[model samples]
Target: MNLNQLKLFYLAVKHQSLSHAAQELNITQPAVTKGIQRLQEYYEVPLVHKSGKNMELTRAGDNLFKIAKKIFELDKLADDCMAEFHNKGLKHIKMNASESFGAYYLPEFINRFNLKAPKVQVTLEVLSNRQVVENSINLKNDIGFVSFPVKDRKLNSIEIIKDEIVIILNPFHSLAKKKYLKASDLEGQMIIMHEQGSYFQKMIHDLLEANNVCVTMPITFSNNEAIKKAVEGGTGIAPISKKVAAKEIESGKLVALSLLSTPLYRTFYMIYHREKHISGPLKQFINLIQQ
Candidate 1:
């Protein structure tokens, strides 16, 4: 089958108008009609029949339309793939990271990388730790920064930084006066928890359970900013990364206190698919962050 004729038929069926297809294809209406005629003649089946001022596809046309749709879609994808290689200087790096590293640390590294490779474009998304790991494993992102060490053999996980998690409370809260708090200190206190099933939430729960500490957790937030805002509003105290709440702590809107009995610390890991080719822009970003 002639692809040119197939494309004309596809477009005509897609729009349900021969003139509209001709307009888009930048050809005369008769040319489009002839193209469709050739396709129907070659296939020995009526591809389309005319209604009152409209074209309707026959069963064969509908079936061929489905296959042609996929063919053109793949054609466009091939074009895009080739375009990327053609514009070598305009490289793109996609990164998925946990909330803390994405908001606090990745920006500085991206800024530095921009100074070095101005042509490279960096796209960053803040996701949960598990989402980051999943994106890395699926090669959806060129790199990922996650809160916990990934044990997947298909991924290369490198420890990037160690962050301390501390309890943050409104400056006016009674617990704000304490230099340090124990898990027992949190007992009976209203706690603002991370979203259920998050790695951070699990870690906090494990710590509290290990110490036999129970706190009233009535509110949950998926992001640190919301948790900090809630704590500042005196809704409840929250356990979050110190760096994440540094601005609030410095402004006295919140107070950060370490856990005396079991200090919470989490290491952030830089992860990427083991088989992923280290492109120049990706390598530069990894190096800058590692340094």
Candidate 2:
């Protein structure tokens, strides 16, 4: 049977009603039934069984239905792959970035890139910073915008801009109104922290060593949003990037302070594989970042 018949069989199993499936396909019920019949004949299996105005798949039919669903999805997958293949020559760029970059930077940056290379198709993938790094050097993604430096030898990095990590505290906390505080001043303070291994975590690790002060971990979280929420609830304090605190600071949900002795700061870096050839779209994007 043809792909159309296969599609009908898949839809029939999904909806469990031949008439409903036919309605969705905008074809007659008999046409849909005929398609399923043709499919079962070709595949030598009954892919659906009806009872009490509803339908269910027999054991063998259930497996066949699952396979049929994947087959249809594969066709769509092929379409996307082919589109990428053709579009690459016409200046297509695929990028994977952290949520902050995708949410804050991509809209205007992509608009500018499109103006520079009108024919390019720019696809942006929003993921965690770690995922961006993984996709980048693994070659699944064309370019990666990461918040920290990566140590991979195959990865090339360009320092984009440095974002200061500010010491944040609850508004009513003793240190909240301070103009500046030193690293030693934070001792014994309830400092909430994100989990380890991230660049920000590494920065904190270095900061403590540089200041020769170590504060006990007050609370820990796995995500930036959770850390911010804990801080907002007056659970504890945290040192975080300016970009992460901008909205909260503006809305008066938190207070930002600088360290007098050990000022916290982190740099954002644009990274890509050194050996990977830059596509025209990615080249334009890199130029846009430089500008």
Candidate 3:
């Protein structure tokens, strides 16, 4: 009828006597008899023969005992599996990030996380700033990284890191020699940019307008790699976060210029849905980037 009763049925069938089963199972003989009676009543069958001192099983009891043995074995296996699932730790983590950090920053951090949790599986998605916001709102990813401010009041966002947006130019460009260029000094120079709706795009547009500097119509690209390539071709100059251009700037291909009279810094955020429950794996990942 129930697991406890089934267990009693199994023990009674094993020992072949209610008194002996009661001794082995730490229950009274009446309790064992009651359990067997309940099971017999539920199935409407006789489970024992009254021919001997040690009872022998009926045909129905043989089949029922076999199943009870299997259930007990399965209970043991279930315990083992749960123990391993907990002891071995989380199996996987799904993470998302915007352009700047996704390409440059996340790989090394994820590698280090794998080292710490070797058994855990991990999938990383590189998304735009908009995608990060939308994914977090929709609870599509366990964690998301974004550069700009997110207005979703229903999400939890942590500004884990911050860095400045620097002017980028090719090595052969005239302005490449300057360590810093003020907004006023940028007048009339060709400038490629990330498309509108990007955090840096809005910031640069506002900064140039406030300082009364305007560049000629120039190429614009939606993503960073294309914009970087366009700048490297001497078509125009664009500003980007220094973290994203570390490799190119280290090499001789491109140069980074600081902005004068401007504090053009963007904060890298770790955002997730507030309603989504934080599992140990997600918490571990947040801890990894937070440090």
Candidate 4:
């Protein structure tokens, strides 16, 4: 039988009388009887009968009543879950981002979000910019954050934030004394870089190559934290987002130098599947970052 009929049948069984069931359901007794009849017809079994002026359930009716009770219980649970998501708050969110943004900036956004929704669960995956784009295009994540603008049309992207890439140097280095650094000044100087495949490394190389500035890179690390530590230890210098090295720069543990040739600025983008529906929590997160 259909769900409407099943609900009527359930109400009839709960009240134990067609007249009482109809009164409670705000329907005519004949309507209740018709609904029960439809259920019995579909199941090909007698659901109830009168015994000495009292309604009693038949053997098949007892089983059906039990099943109907479970169905309504589950339906109530589903309603409660959806109500919480729609009205009170969201329960979960999945996010993906590149290493620099995820490590340096996303945590602040998450902290702000937690202030608004303390109980909501949020998980973030730190990957490469290319990986972030792929995950967004594949709908594997609810939101993607990347350091560079994503050019793919399959994914909708918007610039969320902007950060400057500054030349990080040891305070003891000679170039650190200069207010402005020329491309030729960095020539032949030791440069600590991120892993070879990193977009930041590629940008640094491209900018330097275009300026005819070549530097030696003897150390490469997979993460910004390690590279920052390497630069602090006077191993070499690197060009990284100022946001990533903000603490070090503020603490005087790292020195930031501006390039005289061309300013290095990176714009981070938020991406998602063009057709994917953004949930409440995801939308709140986007707003938090944008703010």
Q: Judging by TM-score against the true structure, name the best candidate.
A: 1
Candidate 4 lDDT, 22-58, residue by residue in tens: 8887999999989989899999999888776566889
| Backbone clashes in model 1, listed as residue pairs | none
TM-scores across all candidates?
Answer: 0.71, 0.64, 0.68, 0.68
Pairs of residues at least 3 apart in sequence or in different chains that clash in candidate 3: 91-121
Superior by lDDT: candidate 3 or candidate 4: 4
The stretch of ten residues in a row with the least summed lDDT in candidate 4 is 76-85
Indicate the TM-score of model 3: 0.68
**Count of clashes, each model:** 0, 0, 1, 0
Which regions of candidate 2 fall more than 4 Å away from where they truly are? 1-91, 99-108, 114-119
**Candidate 3 lDDT for residue 188:** 93
lDDT of 2 by residue, 1-291 (tens): 588997888888777788888999999999998988897899887767888887788887788777886576556445545665675557567788776567666677888877878887779988889899987765667788877778998689898767778888778888887898888888777788877666677788788877787787857787778888888898888988777788999999999998887676777788887766665456768888987
The residue ranges of model 1 lying beyond 4 angstroms of the native Cα positions read 1-85
Error of 3 at 264 (Å): 1.2
Question: How far out, in Å, is residue 46 in model 2?
Answer: 46
Better-scoring candidate (TM-score), 2 or 4: 4
Task: Report lDDT (Cα) of residue 72, candidate 1.
Answer: 72
